[model samples]
Target: MFSVSIKASSIPMSEREPIQSSMQISRTTGQGGEACLLLTGSCTLSALGRRMGDLSDELASYASDPNLHWDLTKIDQMDDVGAVLLWRSWGGSRPEYLSIRPDQERLFSRLGKAPPLPSLPAREPLWIAVRIGGGAILLWEHLTSIVILAGQLLLDMKYLIAHPARIPWREISANLFRTGAQALGITALVGFLIGVVLSYLSSKQLQMFGADIFIINILGMSIIRELGPMLAAILVAGRSGSSMTAQLGVMRVNEELDALTVMGIPHSLRLVLPKVIGLGIAMPLVVMWTSAIALMGGMVVAELQLGLSYQFFLHNLPDAVPLANLWLGLSKGVVCGMIIALIACHFGLRIKSDTESLGIGTTNSVVTAITVVIIIDAIFAVIFSDVGIR
Candidate 1:
């Protein structure tokens, strides 16, 4: 009994408590002879953290040696994730020489018995067709949801009108600050840069044709009528839209959305309405600000490149761009702002209670909002094509 105790005590430390030790790999014999790659310590997901990739790579490298034994008998803790990871590293088969605990052996046995994932057809020609059909179905579903949301928002508007005291004033004000005030810096910088580039490129072209004065027409008509509202809507769709989706998604994740519903609070009346109205009111102002800053940038560049005066640019601007154009741009702003808010809220309210869904919903909201904004702009351009132009 004393000799047996001494021999047991002489055994490798890795054969002891894996809970207290970090996982590692070591060879049981010299490199030139037959070797065994002994795995030790905890093999659970919580233990692996970020080192799974590196460990997988090392395992794969050692797996190339057909004669090497994979010794997992010393491992004391392992979950399915770690085991599956090993199964994949071994190319879906056990190593030629493996030493494993009975419990661990059961895990690999189950993995081996599990049905393989259904494979795709070989070089299917209808793959793109299938994808397009799926996208169309998704788009139709989104459109239906959006229309329902819009109708609900309209009803909410009626409800608020009848019960003025129930209006979400604080929510609207908060959204105004978030979607409008916080967005000014980026809009200003992008607008100014766009103006400078437009002016520089136009000046060079106009100089060749001896039509330097036309720069004012180009800058004023394009910036005021098209670029201003477009830039503002795109930026808001990406920034404020994504933010709204994420906010609602997080609320859903935290079960706050469910709580509100239980309290007899409708999302459209309280949450969605505020964002729509706030952004609707704020969008025109943002568009006006972006247009003004951009024109200033253009004016500066025009003065330097074409010897044009700021006063001259400002004076000709009124004649070059009609009042109708400014109003048209503002109308676009209102529509875009409301639509962006609606799309964001629609996507947000539909988000499943998961981090993965939250991320996916936010991304889809931004992309869909931007695409819809562009579509709206195009429709406006077609219907009001002659309204703003000379």
Candidate 2:
């Protein structure tokens, strides 16, 4: 009898290991006078996936023969993975001439009757209306909380006014000193630099029109009426407001706020009101201080750039910018400071009891305070436009 050779080299070199699990396929005469594929050896999940290429590479040679058959009588072992692989090779159906044991036939018949794999659900498109509605709900909640906090603060203030002895003067004093005295240096430096730059730029433009004297008016009106208070508010928001929020948040994390409540202490009156009243009292003074320093800075630049005397600048400043503008700026400081303190305390109280909450509360307090300050400044500009214009 002549023997035919089957080579593992027929598969890719990556699967050429002689010791690995493998399959043998050979062309042989079938019962109906056609060539068919002979599958033999152990066909199982353990080896079928790794030896897939060895069988798939030669499957096409006997596929078109009308009498093609599967002779699996020599298969020592079989599994679902091997059964499915052979089923697919036969165009996902059983061959009429399949010669196998009762168990293998039952396995192929069960696999054929199994339902198709479920398809994945399609993805849905995003809806803008849902997103907008959710955002609106969140914004409404925040605004309502702020309004309620403001009302509580007003009630506390009215009570303090009626009973002065019950007020927490010591806490107020400490916060004032911390937020005001400690902040003076940076506020002065920033105000001075701003004034100098404003004067320098104004001198260049005014000199073109022989309007050098008007630089005093420009610098005075801009600094005292707008820049001074806005600058001070922003600086304090970033510095003092963040600290307040962090302090309260830390207290919350440590459960000191709850302890205070247990001892019959009102957190709003002791913690929140003190900060609010302190900042409201200190802010106007800080604004005036910043404005004076900035004006001095403007005077120095004027003297050097336009040969304008300090006396002329001082004398003209009062006439150029009215006392009403100074009052407007001071009022802005009071409103802005109260808002900042309240907002800081509000966020601080909302903090979750954790280190991450402390940091997030402080950052949110600073950002919200600064944004509110600018928005209030704009509203003041619109309402009092005719009052402060020189």
Candidate 3:
């Protein structure tokens, strides 16, 4: 059997005023050679009166013992703080041989039932199959939305055909100016540079064989049939497609589209149909203008580098390049314009009610329009490889 005693500096109830109280802690050996702590006097904030450093240190030494017991029968008064101190000394749980009055037992019971502190959520890595499946689902959702938008536009077109007066001619003209007329300067500038570079390079190779006159054939066929339509389409996709998406996205964010719906305005007819038709009408004209300007540039380079007269270049250009190639390029222009407008409207309608969504929708609209244009151009090349080539 062993023993340890701790005395506090507080005045005991009997030694001072009746309201004054003090605490004391003592240790003893229990049955079966276990260690025990006996808590006596008032075990409360006001009663303990001073910090129980000595008592806590005395108890801490026996913390590693598995058979430690606490006897709380002699506690005359206790509050939450006092209960918490003793509860912590017992490793936050009751010991096997604890002895406490019914009132003190209730204090410890409430502490034990308190909700635990919150912890951070665990981060788990996703399986490879789950990631791939999720991506496939998202791709399907986007494709379905695009198809629905196209069907709505088609229905609106039929309605307009029956009711010609309800057609939005004013909107169509405005979009034509924005998407096509405004883009002419950049398209012409790029086309002229492309023509000059192609002529210069072709002159170098044709001159080696003393066949400099064939620069007209190579330059006319390449620019009118392929480069002209492609340049116009790509420029429109970057400049005008992104604008359409941003405009619709802002309308969605501001709830303007909802207001239009409430006012009995069909969104597809008012917003999407005019833009598509306008671009379709304007794109062919842009292609023709770009091709004309590029041919003039090629003629200038041929006159300067190949010592070929402008008159000879012009007179032979029509005979050297077939008319079918010109028609093919204009046809590509009309199709590409409708495609760009459709892709823009598709992403625009998907924007959420936030500025971040507006930016993301615009970026996606431009990228997807350009990608579709290249894919379609490739398909056109493969299918018409024999038709336009001489």
Candidate 4:
């Protein structure tokens, strides 16, 4: 029989004492060359519990010992807190050599076993056609609402015509100033640059054929028939239409429109009518101003690059571009203005009692206004295309 040798080293008391205690292993030799261990002291539940390194060291030292046995016989306390260490150290087998008392089993069970992890759900692809179909339905509903509003406007036309004097001139003037005056600078600048670019492009091709003298024809037809009215309408739609929608939407949220109705005042006359009239009046003027500036810009380009005289450019502009072109541009402006004003008022009246609705209505007004403008322009394009005007 091999005699058991005891080598005990007393550890100093410190913050990590409880953890160190679990690491302390007692080696003993028993009958028939049996080697055993006594696992003692603190684990996870203890105030200054066992260190992970302590468990690792124990597992490593026991790994090479195929016939090693452990004994918990002298363990005054035990826990599942060290169950993982024991199970792993014993090659994932229960430590059969170490007998756990009944009371020790109850405490070990309380530490709980690890649970299985959950699996992730798979992703599905989106059906884009269905989403677009739903959007189309929503767009149809919006258009139906606009048609109903138009009918209401038509029904109230008699009342409006009878009481033209009751129209809010002050409000109309203010909206006109905003829609027209404020947009003039930007519209003019854009128109001028467009005219310069058009003249330059046409000059490039015309110079090859010695027709650079006809640059005025390109500038006049392009600006008056298309660019002038389109640019002006778009600018007003974005600026004034958005403002009108947001303003009326705020008023609707605050119940001011209702209050006016209760006070025996007309909501349409006080709000919608003024904006509509103002936009109608201002749009043609803005288009005229834009067209004039564009022509001037084209004249400068023609003189500098194409070597055409300012007098020749101006003289030929009227013949090359008829007054009908100006009228057509003005007509487009008037129609665009009415569409923008109507859309803004319609969205404004539909606003809910929230700031978000005001924002939505304002955005809707600009988008709807621009869409209507383009559609109307397309119609005009088809109508004018047969007249032999470029």
Candidate that scores best on TM-score: 1
Clashes of 1: 0
lDDT of 4: 0.76
Which candidate model has the greater TM-score, 2 or 4?
2
User: Comparing 2 and 3 by TM-score, which wins?
Assistant: 3
Q: What are the per-model C-alpha RMSD values against the true structure?
A: 7.5, 10.5, 12.0, 11.8
Model 3 over residues 168-222: C-alpha lDDT tens digits? 9999999999988999999999889888988888998999999998998998898
Per-candidate clashes, comma-separated? 0, 0, 0, 0
Per-candidate Cα lDDT values, in order, are 0.90, 0.85, 0.85, 0.76
Q: What would the per-residue lDDT of candidate 4 be over residues 1-390, giving only the tens digit for each residue?
A: 111111112223354444444445677787767887656654434622536666667666775576667765455334465656555566655554655655555544453355546777654356587678879998998899888776766655667678777657798899889888888999899889888888877888999999886787788888998999998888888888888888888888889988999998776767777787788889999999998898888888888887899889888888898788888999889888878888999888889998887887788789988989999999999988766364
In model 4, which range of ten residues has the least summed lDDT?
1-10
lDDT of 4 at 336: 86
The best-first sequence of candidates by lDDT reads 1, 3, 2, 4
Local accuracy of candidate 1 as per-residue lDDT tens digits, 268-381: 888999999999998998999899889999999999999999989888999998999899889999999999999999999999998999999999999989999999999999
Flag regions of model 1 displaced more than 4 Å: 1-133
Question: Against the hidden true structure, what lDDT does model 3 obtain?
Answer: 0.85
What are the runs in model 3 whose C-alpha is more than 4 Å off?
Answer: 1-124
Please estimate how well model 1 matches the true structure, expressed as its whole-model Cα lDDT: 0.90
Every model's TM-score? 0.73, 0.68, 0.69, 0.65
